[model samples]
Target: MQANTVEQIAEVQRKYEELQQQFRAEAAEREAAAAAATREVEQRKKYDELQLQLQQMIQMF
Candidate 1:
């Protein structure tokens, strides 16, 4: 292949690798956000349950 053609191919390959890296990073960030949301929901549920139990105990006294 000609030198110019080879250079063009190399440039394309570099751009593709950069895009792949960005895609992976974005996917990781999304996964982390989803996990955090799940944790928050779980904590809220626990807090509500505790509050309910406290109210029940107070009524007994």
Candidate 2:
């Protein structure tokens, strides 16, 4: 009976480790996606500013 208990504890520990690793991986992916979105937004803002300047120049001509 003691041996069976030990086996069960070991199995639980293994599963716990697996879940911890998966959580960490998901967190990292989420962080990377957020960073990418931030960069995209910044690029879009710059592009819009440039477009506005171009339109002003066209009106001057």
Candidate 3:
């Protein structure tokens, strides 16, 4: 009975470690995706500003 209990405890610990690793990986992926989205938003803003400037210049002509 004692051996069985030890085996069960070991199994739970292994599962817990696996879950922790999976959670860490998922967190990293989420962070990377958020960073990419931020970059895209910044690029879009720059493009819009350039377009406005071009329109203004054309109007002066």
Error of 3 at 21 (Å): 0.6
How many Å off is the CA of 45 in candidate 3?
0.6
Q: Local distance difference test, per candidate?
A: 0.99, 1.00, 1.00
Worst 10 residues of 3 by lDDT: 1-10
Relative to the unseen true structure, what is the Cα RMSD of model 1? Answer: 1.2
Looking at model 3, the pairs that clash are none
* lDDT (Cα, tens digit) per residue for candidate 3, span 9-56: 999999999999999999999999999999999999999999999999
What are the runs in model 3 whose C-alpha is more than 4 Å off? none
Candidate 3 residue 54 C-alpha distance from true site, Å: 1.3
User: Where does candidate 1 have its weakest 10-residue lDDT segment?
Assistant: 1-10
- What is the TM-score of candidate 3? 0.89
Cα RMSD, each candidate: 1.2, 1.1, 0.9
